[model samples]
Target: MARDIADDGVIDGLRAAATADFETARAMPPEVYTSDRFLALESEHIFSKEWYCVGRSSALPAPGDYLTCDLAGQPIMVIRDNDGNLRAQSNVCLHRMSTLLQGRGNAGRIVCPYHAWTYNLDGSLRGAPAMSRNSGFCKDSYRLPQVRCEEWLGWAFVSLNPDAQPVASRLGALEQMIAGYDMTRYSEAFFEEHVWDTNWKVLAENFMESYHLPVCHAGTIGGLSKLDEMICPPGHDAFNYHTILKDESLRIACAHPSNDRLSGDDRRMTYLIAIYPSLLITLTPGYFWYLSLLPKGPGQVHIRFGGGMSDDFKGDADAAENFRQLKALLDDVNIEDRGCTEKVFRGLSSPLAQAGHLSHLERPNYDFARYLLDRIETGQGAV
Candidate 1:
C-alpha cells in the first residue's frame, strides 16, 4: 500500500510533459502526491528557499508578542521586538535543542521552559543559568539562530534559507492586481488551522481553480460561481490566479454592501491565487482569506486558513455580525474541500490512477504542475 517515489523517473515523466498546452496538459503522476522521497526533495528545493507567510503582522501588533510555527519542518518563531520590528528565528533552545515556545503569547523575554535558558526578543542570550560552567562558555557569544523575516501589506513572512529573496520582488504584480483593496488596512477577523488528510498539492490544486465550485462546494459559495465565468489566466513565475463572478442573486454571497464604492469587476468578482509553494489567497472587495499549506507527509498537510476585512468592512457597525456569517460560510467550504481532497489522496493509489487531461478550468493546476516540475528538475526558483 506504499508508493514508490524513490525513482527519479517518476519526476522525469512529469518534466517530459511540462510543455503541453493547458487543455492537453496531463495531471502530475500519482506518486508525486504520495511519495516520501519526492516530498523531501520539495522541502529542500522549494519550501526551504521560499519566504513563507506565517500570519498577518497585526497578529503580533505589540512588542513582545510572538507566534510559534514550523515551515518545511523548520521550527521557528515570529515576534515583535522591543523596537517594534518583527523578527524570526530558530525557536529551538541552544542549551539542549528543546522547543522554546508554543502557540502565541506576549513575553518580554523568551524563556526556555525545559532548561530555563533566557533570550531577549532580538534573540540574544540573556541568562544560561549554569551554562557558564562550561570550559569555553561565553554567554555573550551564544544566541538563538535568526531566520530571515519580512512584511508586506501587513502580512509577515519568514524564510529558513539565508539567501531567500523578498516576497515583494516576486509578488509585485499580484499586489497591484488587488491594489484597490488596500490589503494593509485589513485586520484579521478569523483564524483557523487544520491538519488535513491529503497531500499538500492536492489541497493546493483545489484552491487554484473554481472548476470544483459547481460540484465540490455545491449549495454554498459555489452556488454563486459558474465555471464559465472563471478566468484562468496564464500564471506568473511566482503564482497563479483566476477570477470568478458572484451570482447577483445571493445578497449575502455578493460583495459587501459597504463596498459600493468599488467599481466594475471589483464589485462583482473575486480573485483567488496560489503563491508558489503553498500560500492560497481568495480576495474580494470587502474581505480576503488565505490558506498556508505545509506538507506533513505524503498523505497529510498542515493548513492555516483565515480571513480579514477591508477598511470599510472592518469599520462597519455590523462587522462582528458579518464576520460571524463569513466564518460560517468558509467553514462549510473547508468541509467540502476536506472531503474531496482526502478522497483524492486515497485515489492516487488506485491501480487505475493515471495522468488525465486538464480541463480549461484547471489551467492553474496545470501551471502548478509545471511550476513543480521545473523546480524539481532544475531547482530554478530558490532565490
Candidate 2:
C-alpha cells in the first residue's frame, strides 16, 4: 500500500506558516522538501493540473517529428502529424503497455518494438501483425489515447488533465506585457536535459528571485544589477514576475544590444516569471531561456532547458559567434546555480532545519509558496 499524504499533519502546519506579507512569511518547511508523501500529493494536485511548456514549436517543425518525455509519471509523446497538427498521445502501445517511442526523431509511424503493432503519426492504428487471427479483434477500436496539447508564443504546452484551462487564458495580461518581444518567431537554438540533485521547488524558487545574484552569480551577470532596482510587483493567480534591472556595467554581451521597437525597459531589463507549479522563464529583449521541471522524488528534479534569439540577434551576421559566447556564459551560470541549490537541499535534511523568515528580495518566492499552499490546502485553482 502507498503511504497516505492526508494523514500527515505537516500539510496543515505548512498552510498555517504561509503568509501574504513577504517580510513576515516563513520559508516552506523542510519536510516539504524531503517527504515522499508530499511529492506524490504534488504530482496529482499540481503537476498533472498545470499547463507546462514541453518545448518550442520550432523543434518538431515537420510532420512526423516528435519529442517524448515522462510527465507526472505518464509516458507521453508529442508529434507533429502529417495533417500539420501538433498532437500529444499516450506513448504506451495499444496492444500492451510497452512504450512506443524513445528519444526524439522523425518517425514514419510509431511502431511498438515489443510487438508488431504500429500506429500512424496521428495516433491511429495502422497495423497489428498476426492479431487478425483473433476472433472479434477490431483494429479501429485501438488507437493511441490522446492527451491535451496547446501552443502559445511559439512554444508547445501539454496537460494531462482534460479539464485544465488553456495556457493563454491563465496567463492573463502577461502577453500584453511581453508583446514587444514577439516570441512567436523565436526558434530553438540550444537544448539539453539533465537531472539535478535538488528538490524541484528549490530550483523553481532559485529562478523566481534575484536575491542570490550578488553572492551566487557575483562575477557574472550579477555585477550589472543593483539591489534597489529589483522590483517584486503583485502577481496574478497564474504567474509571478519580477524585474532584474541592468545597467551598462555588464561585462559580456549576454543580451542583444538593442531592438528599435522595444520600449526602453524591455531592452534593458530581464524579466523572470514563475507560472505556477513548475514553468520558469527568463525573458529579455534579445533572447530568452526557460526551465521546466519535473520532480522525480522529493530530492530529484528533471530539467529541460533551452534558449532562442529574437530576430534582432538571429539577423546579425555574427550571431553564431555571439551564441557561442552566450552559451559559455550560460553554462557557467548553470554550474553556479546547481551547486548552490544542491547545498540547500542537503541543509534541509538537518535536524535543526527550520523555515526561516523571508526577505523583501524573496517576494516572488513567497508568491510561489502561497501558490503551493492554495493548491494543496485551500484547493485554490491555478488561475
Candidate 3:
C-alpha cells in the first residue's frame, strides 16, 4: 500500500498546517516574529553558526580595498590585502572597541581614530601610537580577531563563529552548481537596500512561495510566469540552485517588440536560486541580480539588491534595452512582495495566531525552517 503524506506528521502545529494549506492564511505567532529574546536566539544559533553572504567580492576589487558591514549585529571588515588575498576581521578597534570603518573604501591600513592604533591591511597589528612602550604591551598579542571568510560565485560570505564549517563544505553540491557558471564575467550596475519588519525565516518562507506572484506582482513577475508553470519541485538539486521560470512570450514582447513574439525557447524566463542562509541570485537574459538578507532583529531585516551584467548582455543593444525593462519589472515585484511581507509581520502580532503547516509545494521552505530551528535550538544560544 502507498503511504499518505498526511500521515507522515512532518508538520507539528495547527495554524502552521492550516496556513500552509490555504493561500489566504493567518500569519505566524506574534512572539516568533516580534520578540527581542527570539531575535537574540536567531543571532546566536542561526546567524553565528551558518555561513552568511554579506556582499559581492566585486565590492572590493583592489588590494587594500575594504568594506565594513555588520555580521549578526557584530561589525566586521572584509578586506583585500596588499597581496590580493581577502580576509575578514572584527571591525572594532582593540583599544576601546570603537568601530573602525563605517562603510566601503580603499585604504592603505586600518587606523583607529580614537587612540590611533594602526593595523596592516591583513589585520596584523603594526603599531599602537603612544602605547607600544607600555609595560607588558606586545604588538604581536594585539592583532585583530579574525573571522572565517570565503568567496563563491563572486560573492563574499562571512561567519561570526570560529568553529563553523568552512563555507564551501557546508554548501556541498551548491558550490558545484554555481561553479559551472562563469561568475566572474559579470559586474555590478546598481545596488540598493531597504529594511523590512519580520522574522528572517518569514522572509525565507516568502521567497520559497510562488503562489503570490500572480496577485502581488501583477505588474512584473505576473506578466511572465503563470501559476501552474511556476510550480517548483522539492530537493537540493541543480534546479533548486539555478532554477529558471521560462516564458518565451514575455521575452519576445520585451525584446523584439516589432516581432509578434509567441511561445518559444528564446522567450522570457526568470531564474532564481538561494545561496543558503542569506543570498538570493536571480537572472534574466539581459540582467543578473543578487539579493542579500541581513537580519537586524526578530522583526527587522535589511534586503539589498545588486545588479550585474555579462559581456553578452552588455554589448548587445537589444539585450541592454531588455535588461533595463527587466530591472524596472523586478524592482516593482520586490516592492510589492515586501509590502505583503511587511503587512504579514504586522498581522503576526495578532493574539489569535499560532504555528503553520507545510504544503507539498512548500516542502523546501519547511525543510529550510526546520533546518534553521534545529541549528538555533542546538547551537550555543540563550536558554
When sorted by lDDT, best at the front, the candidate numbers are: 1, 2, 3
**Tens-place lDDT digits, model 1, residues 194-295:** 899889999999899788888898768777887777899989889999998877664433466666556776686788978888888887766689999898
> Poorest 10 consecutive residues of model 1 by lDDT?
249-258
The order by descending TM-score is: 1, 2, 3
Which segments of candidate 2 are over 4 A away from where they belong? 1-7, 249-258, 378-383
Q: Give the clash total for candidate 3.
A: 9
lDDT of 3 by residue, 1-383 (tens): 11112311322222253334334333334455566665666677767767777677888889988877787778999999888889999999988998997777888988888888899987888888787467988888888889889986677888877787676566666655444334565678777777887656677667766666678778676656666555455545212432445565555222233323223433344555665676777654435777788787666788877875554455566766766776776688778878888877766666655555444455456445545445554664324
Clashing pairs in 1: none
For lDDT, candidate 2 versus 3, the one ahead is: 2
List where candidate 1 sits over 4 angstroms from the true fold: 249-261, 380-383
**Per-residue lDDT of 169-276 in model 2, one digit per residue for the tens?**
888588888787677856679889989999999999999889899899986778778778999887778999998767744412234555566655656777888877
Candidate 2 CA-lDDT value: 0.81
* Among all candidates shown, the one with the greatest TM-score: 1
**TM-score of structure candidate 1:** 0.95
